[model samples]
Structures are given as C-alpha cells and as structure tokens.
Target: MSMPRSIGSGPAPRHGSIARSSFSASYLSQSPIAQESIARDLAEYSDDEIEQPESDSEESGSEDESDASTVRPNAPQHSMASSYRRPSFVAFGGTRPAITPHGAEGTFLTKKEKKQARDEERSLLRDNHLAPPKHPEPSRRNTLSRIYKKVFSTKTPKTESDLEDPPEALFSAEPSESSTLLSNGPPESKRSRREREDREWEAAVASGKIKTTWQREAKTLMTNASPLVITFVLQYSLTVASIFTVGHLGTLELGAVSLASMTANISGYAIYQGLATSLDTLCAQAYGSGRKHLVGLQFQRMVYFLWALTIPIGIFWLLAEKILELIVPERESARLAGLYLRILLLGAPGYSAFEAGKRFMQAQGLFSSCTYVLLIAAPLNAFMNWLFVWQFKWGFVGAPIAVAITDTLLPILLFLYVRFVDGRQCWNGFTKKAFRNWGPMIRLALPGLLMVEAEFLAFEILTLASSYISTTHLAAQSVLGTVTALTFQIPFPISIAASTRVANLIGATLSGAAKTSAKVAFIVACGVGLFNVALLFFLRSYIPRLFTTDPEVIRLVSTVLPICAAFQLFDALAANCNGLLRGLGYQEFGGWVNLFCYYVVAMPISLGTAFGLGWQLEGLWTGPAIALGLVAAAEGWFLTTANWEKAVEDARERNSNG
Candidate 1:
C-alpha cells in the first residue's frame, strides 16, 4: 500500500508500507452518479474504520496461511498471508508494487508479477478503497461503462413503484414502451405519442392507478371551449350591435331598446336557453353512449316543445303596453317598448329553435358548423340593423324587426346545415318518437329553465328596482350591465363546454373524467374572472364614456363599476358550476341553489341596502355580488367533492328514460 506525500507535499509511501487512498476531486466531479456512489460508500465506512489502519497480525496471518496450505495441500507455498496485505495508492510519479507468489516476501518481482500487482492496485483504487479484493472485481473500465450506461440509456420503468413521473408528465411525450424504440423501432410522431398517452391514461383510470390531472382536464375543456367562446361572442354581439345601431336614433330609442332587450332576456330568451340545456344532457349522453341518432331526435323534440310554449309568451307580449304602463313611468315610452316587444316576440320561437340546434350541434362536437352559421348570422344581423334602422329610417321598430329577422334566420341556417350538410347521421329527418317524449322533455327542461330564470329574474329585479331610484341611475345601471354582460360571455361559453364535456364523459362511464371536467371548468372560470377584474378595473373610469359622455351618468357608473368588477370572479365560478349541474343532470338542485342564493339571500340584501340603508345603486350591485360569492362557494364545493359515479349512472338513466 502507498499514500501521497502529506496528501500533497510529502513523499509517497515506500513500497510494501500501509497507506490509504482518497479519490481525486476531478474524477469524482466528472460523473455525478459515480461521485454519489463513492460518497455513499464512504459514509458506510465509519470514521474509526477508515482512519485506523490495522497493524500486521502475525497470528491471524499465520492462521490464514495455515488454512490456505490445508486447502492446497500439495502447494504449501501458496500462503493467504500474501493476499492479506493492503494494496498501494501510487500516483503517476510513484513506484508500482511487485506481485509476489504465496510465502514469497521481502523480494522484488518479475515484469509480469509487477504488472499484475499494479493492475490489482489500480482496480482497488478505482473503487476508492485500498482493501484487498473480497472476491474479484471486473476491469476498472467497467465502472466507467456503468456510468455511461446510466447517462445515455433509456429503460422502461419495471413497476408502478419505479415510476417517478409527475401528474403532468403522466401524459407527457416520453416513450415508455422500450429503450430501443429509437433504434430498433419506427419513429414516434407527436400524434402517435399523444395517442399512446391516451391509451395509457384510459388503462390507468380503469385500473385506478391514477386519476386524470386537473391540468389535462382543463386543457381538454379549453380545447373544446375556445371556438365555442368565439362563437358565443359573435352570436351575442348581434344583440350588442342592435343596441349600438339603435342608440344613434335618439335617447328615447336607446332607453326603449334597452328596456325591450332586458324584458326579452328575462321572459323569453333565458327560459328558451335554459330549456334548450335539456338537450345538452340528452344529446351529449346519447352521443357518448354511441346512440348518435338519438341526439337529433332530442333536438327536434326540444324545438317543438319550446315553440309550443312560446304561444302564450307571444300573447303576453301582445299586452306588453299595459304591463309596461304599470312599471314604467312614461306612457309614451311604455307604448314604444310594447311595440318593440311585439316585434321581438316574433323571434321567440326562432331563438328557442336556434338554442336547441346549437346545443344539439355542440353535444355531437360539431362546433364548426354552428360557429360558421353564427359567423354569417352575426354580421348579417348587424348589417340589417344598420340598413333597417339608420338607412331605412324605420327608427325603433326597425331595430326589433332587424333583430327578429336575424333571429329567424339562425334556426333556418342551422336546420339547413343539419339537413343538407352536417349532422345527417343524427337528424334522421325528425321522428314521431320525438313528439311522444313530451313528458320527459318537460321533466328535464323545467328544472333547467327555473335555474336560469331565477338568476335572470334576480338581475331583472335589480334593474326594475334601479328604475324606482331614478331614471338616471337606471340608465347608468344599464350601461354597467351591458359591460358586465359582454365580459360574462367569456365564462358563458366555458360553462357550456364544460357541461357538454362532462355529460359526454359520464355517458361513456368515465366518472373520473367527468369529475375532472367539472374541476377544470371551475378553475378556468376563476382564471377568466381574475382577468375580467383586471380588465374592468383599468377601464372602469373610461368604459362609461363608451355608452354616454354625460358626466353625471359617468360619475355614477364609475362608482358602481368597481363593485361589479370585484364580483366577476364569483359570477364566473357560480355560472360555470351551474353548467356543471346541468351536465350532471342536477338541474333541479341548481334551481334550488339559485332560488335560495338569489331570491332569499341576495334580493333582500339588495332592496334593504339600497332603500333601507340608502346605499342606492352601489348597494343594489353589492347584494348580487354577495349572492354570487355564496353560490360560487356552494357550487364549487359540491362539484369538487360530488360523487361522479352517481352522476354517470344518473346520466345513463336520464338518457334511458328519455
């Protein structure tokens, strides 16, 4: 054994003298895995063992030699004592040790013996130890080979316990099949990787090895929702554009159009939208369960049911003048609002039919045609409003007429698309079975309608209450409401997408996926809400100027807009959760939640804070904010923790019974 001079300054150990060896820092630094292994081995050898070199024991060495002689009886010269000596740690400048045969000592060796001794010492040093070999180590280069093997080799994990992947990476682009995939196999494209991940995910879920990641679920929801959101913005702009066009007519026309729009929203539009959601559940489940054609029939049934319900609604609109006279202060404005209402009433059936068609298309994942149809209808609606109201000089009546024509055109467009181009597999040309399912349609629709109606009526009540305070406050509230409505379009599409996706997954008996969809929907809605808050916070002072430059109205709007901005998060979450309920077929429960949160909790707070506490418009806005918070909290908790297995069963039953 040999040691370096003072580890740096002293002479090397004389040959045949005991010495210790330490690895070079440069060698250890070259390979982290080697360094780690060496460090671990060093730790295993305690301080007392490494620091204290044992003295030569003649008794033990003699006994080992005697045992070796007994084993090799004919060769008593084969002494184990020779093998008991510590190896040398010679640097490049130091003399190498001589290899001696058994019982040979105090003598120099031949060239072959010295070479063998040097090789043995090198092997021991490569292992960072000076002890003699226990059995035998392979060549020193083998250690380096192992390190390189670890560095470059890609091996599939043998067991679930061996897998250290994060949830995000569970669906990552890695090839887990084999290490030889790159060399001995075909090249894997991105699409193939994604498909492999999909198969793996389904297997994992089935075996309960892993649940779907919320991030992956959100990505799925966003992938499905993005185009739908664009479509919604385009479709909703039809109404906004109508308002913009009519605003150029006169202040009276502006107020009349605003009132008529709000009335139509609460009375007819919201109900129709809610009722159409029934198809979201039925169609999505049917499509997912592989009964694709049933979705089309369900869409037809929804349209028929909604159109029949619109008859009495039209009669109610015919008496809109008298109804407006009771609530509205000005008789002339009331008379004009009535006329606007009657014209808008002609679009009610069309609106309902469009909603049904939209949900049907969305359920089957045929979003492109719906978007293309709305893409044309939205701009056409705007053009007609411009032509009929401004160019034609038809004034207030022309706005409603243009809106009616646009609304009527949507269903015809969607119907033509389904009949001639898309959804032919599901359409089957309308069936008698659809007419017979009136009872089931009503059962499913009423709860959804009530759920939407409760929330809609709550806002409408606030609008009506604002009118009592002052017409100026009413107008300011309307401007703020419009801004909120536009921002709301962001989450509205997310809810619809989430609902459809969840229902689809549930129908396929993928309960875990359904739950993931709900979770992702809630999370994305919150993110969008935060964005809305930031956007509106920056624009609060300037947004009012878009609708009007009147300082008084602007000042009032500026005061209330911040409060509205603050509620955007809760509003987004609550709205998306409601969508979750619709997809889970818990529309009845959602109706109760809205009824309690808005009517019982929010309405009183609003009326009391505004009139009793004299906070006025801000107070009125504050109540809805509080209600939205409560609803978001309640619904978020339920959706996050609800029994997704039961949701799947319920979806199956709903589709089965229908």
Candidate 2:
C-alpha cells in the first residue's frame, strides 16, 4: 500500500476557500511518505548487521557460529564469507595449494596460522578456477518483473515454473547464503516484507525506541511544506499566464479573461475537482487493504463520473454568452468571456482526467508526479500564451486556445509517466468493475462538492456583490482577492503536509505522536499567519499598485487591505484545522462548518454591511473576516475534542473491510 493510505480513508478533504490550491506535492523532502520510504530502506539492516564487529567475530568463529545458530536454524549451515569470493581477486588460477593436515581436520590454529591457511585455500580455489563470481543471480523472477510481464507481455507461461523463472538465467556467479536459500525456497513477497517491517516499526514505537518531539515534527512539517509551496505557486501560474498575456491587449481583454476564468472555475473546474476527491478515501482504503488494483479502479470511476457531468457543463458554456449578457452590463466583455469558456470546453475532459489522476497518484504516494508534470506544463503554458497571442496574432481567441492545449497536455503527460516510469503496479488494465461502482463514489463525492462549491460561491458572491457597488469597488475586490490568494498559497500547502503527517501517525495507532504533530501544525500555522499579516499590513499601500495603476482602485484596496490582513491568522488557523480534521477522518465536519459559516453567517453580514450599512468594499470584507474567525474557532474546537483513537479504529475498519 502507498503511504497516503495511512492518513485516513475519506474523500480527500479539500479546504474550501475563494481560491483553493490543488497541487499535492506529498513525496518530496521530509514528507511523511519520504520519511516512510527512509524507514523502509533502513529496515533492511538488522541491529547485528549494523553494529557487529568483523574483527571480534573473525577471532571467535565458534562463538559467532553459536550466535548464528541461535538466530536461525540454517544460519550456522551457510557461511557467506567462505561461500562467496571474487574469482578475479584470487591467485594461482589452476593449481591446488598445499594445506596443513590439522587445518583440514578443523584443529584449532593461531591467528597467523589461520590467515596463512585462508590464503592457501583461496589460492587453491583460484588455481582450479573455482573462486565465486560477484553478485550471483537470483533463481526466480522478482515480483515486479513477473507483474510487468503478466500485464504487458503477450506470451503466456506454459507452466508454473515458467512463471516463476525468467526466460534466461545467468550462472556466471556464486550465490550468497540468502540467495541460495531463496533458490531452494519461494522468494518473499512484497506484502509479507511490508507486514514484517510494520511489525518491527510498531514494536519499536511500543518499546519507546521511537519518540515524537516538537523539534522533529516542526522540521518534518517545514521540509514537507516547502516543496508544496513551490508546486502550488507554479500551478497557480497557469491561470496567471492567461491574465498576464491578455492584459497587454487592453483593459477590456483583461477583464474579459478574468471573468471567463472565474466563470469556468465555478461552473466547470471546481466540480471536477470536488468529484475527484472521493478517490482519496476509496483508493486509499483499497490500497491499504493491499488491493492495489482498486486504486486504478477508483481513478477510472472518477474520470468517467466527471466526464459524464461535463455534458451539462458543456451546454452551459455553449450558452454562456447569452447567460453572461443577462447579468453583466458590459456586452463586449461578456461576449468575449463567453467565447473563452466555449473554447475552453475542448479541454474540460482532460482537466477532469488530470484531477482524478492526481488523486490516483497521491493514493500511491507518488506526490511529486504532479509537481514534476507542472514543472514542464507551467512554463510551456506561458510560452504557449505568448506564442499564440502575439507571435501567431490570434489575439483574444489565442489565450483560451493556449489554455485548452495546456490543460489537455497535463493528463497526457501524467499518463506517460504512469505507463512507463512509475505507478503502473496499481493499474491492472481497464476492467468492467469501474462501470459498476457508482453509488459509493457519488455518496462520498457530494459533501466534498457542496463544501467546495459553497465556499467558492460565497467568495464569488462577494465579487458579484462588489460589481453592484461600482466598477471601482469591483476592481479593488480583484486586487484584494489576488493579494489574499497569493498569501493563501503558503499556508494551504503547510496544512496538507500537516494532514498527511497526522494521518500517518494515526494509522500507525500512535495517538500521542499524532497529537504532537497536530500541535506542531498549529504552531507553524500561527507563525505563517503572523508573517502574512505583517506582510500585508506593512505593504498595504504598495501592494495594490502592483496589480493596478488606477488611483481609485489603489486607494480602495489599500484602505480595505487591513481588514483582509486582520483575518490572516484566522484563515491560516482555519486551513490547518480543516487539515487536521481530514487527518482525523472528520472532514465531513469541516465541510458542514465551512458551508454554514461562509453562507449562513458570512454572506448575510457581507451583503448587509455593503448594501444595508453602505460601508461599501470594507463592509463587503467584514462578512468573510468574521466567517473565517468562526470557521477557525469551530474547527479548532472540534479537533480539540476529537476522538483520535476512534479515527485509528475507523482506518483499520476501512482497510479490513476493503
């Protein structure tokens, strides 16, 4: 099973905010998966292997043999040092060297005499061309090679032995003791090895050989979060590229593209992402249960489901021009925005597939796959915008075309990676099972959809509400939203890192360590919140100018900046709280909290303050700030009282049932 299964089995809970970050860079640096990988590698070395002294063991062969006999029945029967030696290193290739009669009969010898006997024995072997070759080949095919062959190779095995062994065997080397034993018996399976390692880890943790501390957790969180920050920034740049390229055309083009993107996000992209989140639970549980093929099955199910929903999405985009004209007063801008969405429809399936694929990879603990994909896609997207918009002189239409192409390219690249490089083991080819399991996936998907859509629509409502006040207020809203979203990119990734870390601890049944991780997450969140608050407060006057040159928009943004800054701590805390909930498998609770806070509380206050009280943009900001505080407070309280032990039980139940 992949490392992510340890986190929990729920719809991969996404925190709802105006502009949520979707990048999951869970494999880099000191991420839980990376740490787990390190632990797995270290498991190969036994304590004796690491600490045993060669000189002491060599001087006391009888004692060493007795110790080996105690460890394993076969241990004293095989001496790896005596059985295997490099043929090229031995002297006297074809002659038998003389040996002492007492040494041959195993009489005790002094250290000098023993060395001389060993040298003579080696010379005899070398003389007879009998010295062992290095790196003896295994007798049977490795597990991965067998799986790959069964899945991809057309030739069928004629017998059981044919499946067990490779087509050709190289016998140019002498076998080590372990290899010799393996040749005599069946090779250990990966599942058995993993189970053994897990038992070892649990034993160590239970015995207090492993301990969690603030400094260690803090360092792990930071190390994991740093790469995610870069990944999120790069992915967000995909949207920014369109804005930057189109802005040069004129204000109208810029506004139209912005409007189009917002429309597409709410109407199309968000739905795909929300639905795809169900895989977080389904795939994770399946993987944890050692049914790896279910990861691909869950992925296929989400992709098909998202694709099915695209019919309505396509119809909406097709008529978006008329729809936008009814609500937006600027006909030309609305027309251009509708045109953009219509063109963007071409890439919707690809975008949906990419979202599902991201979750599939995440379930396999291949977090850096998407990051690596974006590293190429993001820069290529920018160049596409420039090439199509200016170089090819397609003007307004060129931007959407560029975006569509980039979106389509994303899943293709991910597919190539899965097909050839990694993540293939989880896929056992397409099956009809994907078409059967619709009920459970949809059940898990709906709450995630509502949670994401509610918060997304609430923020979009604020933007729409600003339009009613005046175009100047609307422009200021854009600048303010961008500033807040930029700051959000940092804390959101930190929350993801925390969520996975806590989840891993819980899965391991380490409630005490999980709590320690939660505390570290909260402290880190507070620090990040304060840093963002200070940044916005100190630079409020200048930050707006970077987005716009208009004096009115600048002044409005600067005046309202402090209000946004005030909630920075709340926003950060709320994000982390939601993450902790996800780790605890109570993400549904966070969804309900966000849905209620943003709509039931935040909306009315924002609308009433802006319209009823006539405080304008500042009044509009009032509602979300209060909502963020409530979200942070409510989720924080839930986490404090949460049953982490119960969460561990739930994870175990899910894995067992799967």
Candidate 3:
C-alpha cells in the first residue's frame, strides 16, 4: 500500500490524485499534475483494488506508507484520512474473497473472524444497500455487526490516509464496484452515471459528510413491485370496466359517467393515497428500525383512521350535487357530476378499506396477493356496474350505486382472502393487543395523509374549473380524464412492485439487486404504456358510444381519441415515475412535481388554451399533453437516476437515529 499525502501536493498512489469538481480541463490541462492524471486516476479508481493496508488496521501509523507514488514528481508530503472499514461484496452474500483486505493469508481473519469482518462490512453495505441479511448464511455476521455497530457506531480512525481531500477534487474519479458487478460494460451513459456516484461517495466519505443510503437499494426483491402491482390491478380492472360499461350508454352519458367517475376517483384516491403513503413511511421505516410487529398494529390503526374519516367523506358524498354545483355552478355539464358524486359516497368506506388492505400487504412485503385480489374485485365491480347501469337501464345514477356496492364489498372480501385464502406471517394473528396499539401506526401514516390532502385540494379546484368550459368541452374532459385514469393504472403495479422489492432489499441491504429492480420497473412501465396506447387507439370510437347516444359527443371524443392514444404513453410514464418516487420515500418530490405540473404548467396550458383560445376541451388536452409529458419524462428520469448505494446509506443513518 502507498502512504498518505497532503491535499494538494500531488495525487497519492493509494488514494490517487483528487480532481477538483471545479477543475476545468481548460485550466488543468496547463498544469503539471495534469500530465500525471492517468496514474492518479488509476490509483484513485482502480476497479481491481479492493485491498486496504494491513498496518492501517492493527498497527497505527502517522503516514501509513510513503506518499511517493506516481503523480508527484517532487513528492511533496500531503495528508489524507481514511478510516471507516470499507465493506466488501461478501458482506452482502456475494463470493467471499479467499484473501483478506491486506491480500495476506496468515494475518487473514479466521472463519469466525472473517464472518465477523464481513458482518461489519454487510452492515455498512446494507446500511447503504437497503436489504437485511436473509437465511443461515450471514446471520451470525450480522449479529456481530449489530453488536459492534452498537458499541462502535461512529467512524474510528486508526490511520490517517487520503481523507482530507477537497470536495471538488473528485471530478476525475472513475469506476466503482458497480462497474465490476457488470461482467460486460454497461452503456456509456450508465457507466458514467456509476462513476459519478462513486465520486460522490468518495467526496462524501472524504469530506466527513455522511453518505445517504438508498431506500430501494436496501432490498429490490419484491417490495415496491408488490404494492404497485396490487394497487394497479385493483384500480385498473374496476376502473376500465366501469368506463367501458358506462361509455356504452352513449357519448353524453358515457362522458358524464366517465368524467364524474374520474373526478371522484382522483378526489377519493387523494385521500386514500395520502393516508396509505404515510403507512409506507411508517411501515418501511419501522421495519428498518427492527419494529416489524409494530407495522401490523399501524396497518390496523390506519383502517380505523380511514373509517373515521369516512363519515365526513360520506357526508361530502351526500352533498355531491352541492359540491359539484359549488365547483362549477354555472355549467350544465356539472349536473351529471353532482348526481354521480351523491351515489358514489356509499362506497367511500370500501374505497378506504381497499387502500388499507394494500398498506397491510405492503407492510409485510406480501404485496403479490394484491394483484390476485384485484382480479377478483375488478371483475365483480364491472359485473355489478354492467348489470345495474346497462342491463337494468338505470342511467348515470345507477353507475354510482353500482360502484358503491363494489367498493363497499371489496374490503370485506379482501380481508377474508387475506385471512383465509392466503395467510401472512404478519396477519396470521388477530388480537386485541393489535387494536390497542395504534401509536406507531398513526405516526407512520400521517405524512402520507398530509401529502394527499395537498394534492387533492389542488386537483379538486382544477376539476371544478374544467366543468365551466362548455357542455361539449365538459363531456370531452370526462372522456379524456377517464382515458388518463385508465392509462395511469399501468404504473401502479410497477410502483408497488418496486416499493415491496426495494423495501425488502433495503431492509436486507442488498444493493445491486435493488438497483436492478428499479431498472425492471422502468422498463416494464414503458412497455405497458406502449401496449395501452395501441389498444386505446384501436378501441377509440367504438368505446365512446357506450356512455351516451349523442353522435356529436361521440364524434368530438373520437377526434380527440387519437390524441389520448398518443398521450397514454406519457400517462404511463407519469404514473410509474410517481410510483418510483413513492418507493424511494420521495413523496415530497411528487408533491412539488405535481404542484408545478398541475398548477403552473398543466392548469394554465389546458384551461387557458381551452377556455381563453376557444379550443375549449381540446385545449385541456393540449395542456396535459405538454405538462403530463414533461412530468412523465421527469419521473422516468428520476427512477433511472437512483443511486442505490446512496439510498442504503441514507436508510442506515435514518434507521440508526430512529
């Protein structure tokens, strides 16, 4: 191993030359150190260099070795500090290195010692990776890590090596373990991104600023994927079927039902989503903190909380007409929406329950069952809606009632299924104790509720405003909104699947897998979006006549159908992006992104162009096309932008404090 050096004298061989983030090649190209950069960069970022100095571990030294490697012709002495034991992949269940950190056989830790060493490494890795150790393999190592972590939780410095580098001196940094994790090269784009992350880690650790652990990197298995899949299946199956069945009524009625339902759903979803998101924070964080049992209690409490809130929700449903009137008092188109809301209230509790059920499964990482349950509930919801609205000729009023029946019964059925058909470890025991302990549960869900509240208030205002444009425009808005709803359903699976997988991986601290899951979700969502757009385009005109018989309404919607078809792909992107953000505990990002997209960009573009420019309903779509497209792109980028190692680090710091 090479010795430590001062910050600016020259790049050391062991730690390498620090490239200032502010260093421009324009200036650095003229410098003496610039000529020696290859050696510095190689030493700094050697992908094969997994070894740390032996003397640095057991024997203390002022300057571990001679700081005279390549880079410095003068070999000016500069110092750096390198403490916290670097973790190896073996700690995370990858192949164990036959040789130790020093590359010696004699001083190498014994099997127990090796396990202990790896355990500490795993803790650090998992702390950044976001997964818990699974099975008989690393349990012993993890336990020792736990004990060691408890006692020596803080970084301990035995040797002073390349630690005091300037923050910017890492720009020239290169590949990370992730680069090697790929046998073949990743795309240039990905390899560059990975290098940036490694430099970030280097800068953070070198600067003594704690690196953030990635949330999804903790456990990418099935955590996020499960929740999203479950939510998507349930919401999409029921929603699409309802739209189709109602659309068959004719354009006017079709649009009205679709419009009102869309409005109602966003509103209701805002509420449930707000509450459920809090459950995610609570459950994931709690699970991270080793409070697994508390998650069950929180799930139960969320149920009651959602139920208690339902009374007011029901009252609001009762005043659906008044609400609609107040929302769009002058618009005749709003009349149908008002009627629909009054009827839809009967199912508020059911809506709340279904959401709670998801949180329950999500808490325990048993999110796979949600898709199964959705399959059951979605079909039932459609059948009931079809039977009452079309077969029975009840009109838009029947649409709401049928939906209520479906929502109300869904929770009860899901609960039975959870208990009987496919049992869970967390849900296996039903107890009074669980009911009595609601403290943590309430804490977990509160943040999510707050977020939902902010989002709902914003959309509610927009929905109300859209009703005034024109009867035709309103109907158009209805159809387009339903299309948006239907298309959005695709990403829920991707998001939930990510949440469950990422959360478990985070808990287990398996980073590489967590990152891969994020990739899987993004790819899957895009593929689904592509498919949805094709199907929607194919079924456009034929689909609209189901709700209303008005040829004009149908004609208007058909003209716009192609636009929706083009936009559906963006819709998928936005939904999936939001899902990915939620999995990463980045709801705040969603809140801000939505605020900008809906209010600043989307609202202005859609409403302004439609109402002000006389494009009316088409204007609404135009705005969404631009705004939603931007949002989808942003979200997709964010999902792909995740640095799982950082996520693991952040989770560990957060968990340790908690």
Best by TM-score: 2
CA lDDT of each candidate?
0.56, 0.60, 0.46
Instruction: State, as a TM-score between 0 and 1, how close model 3 is to the true structure.
Output: 0.57
Candidate with more favorable, higher lDDT: 1 or 3: 1
Candidate 1 error regions (>4 Å): 1-203, 206-218, 248-250, 274-308, 359-365, 426-444, 495-526, 576-592, 635-658
Q: How accurate is candidate 2 locally (lDDT)?
A: 0.60
Q: Please provide, for model 2 over 388-470, each residue's C-alpha lDDT reduced to its tens digit, 9 standing for 90 to 100.
A: 99999999899899888987998999999998888887786876666764776787667556544553465667766776676
Task: Quote model 2's TM-score.
Answer: 0.66
lDDT of 2 at 44: 45
Clash pairs (backbone) in predicted model 1: 1-88, 5-10
* lDDT string, candidate 3, 58-169, tens digits: 1332111221111111111110011111110001000101011110000111112223322333343223322222322344567788786556443222223324432224
Which prediction has the highest lDDT against the true structure? 2
Collision count of model 1: 2
lDDT of 1 by residue, 193-285 (tens): 323433543444354443344545666677767875575467556656666766555445556665665576566765675566555445544
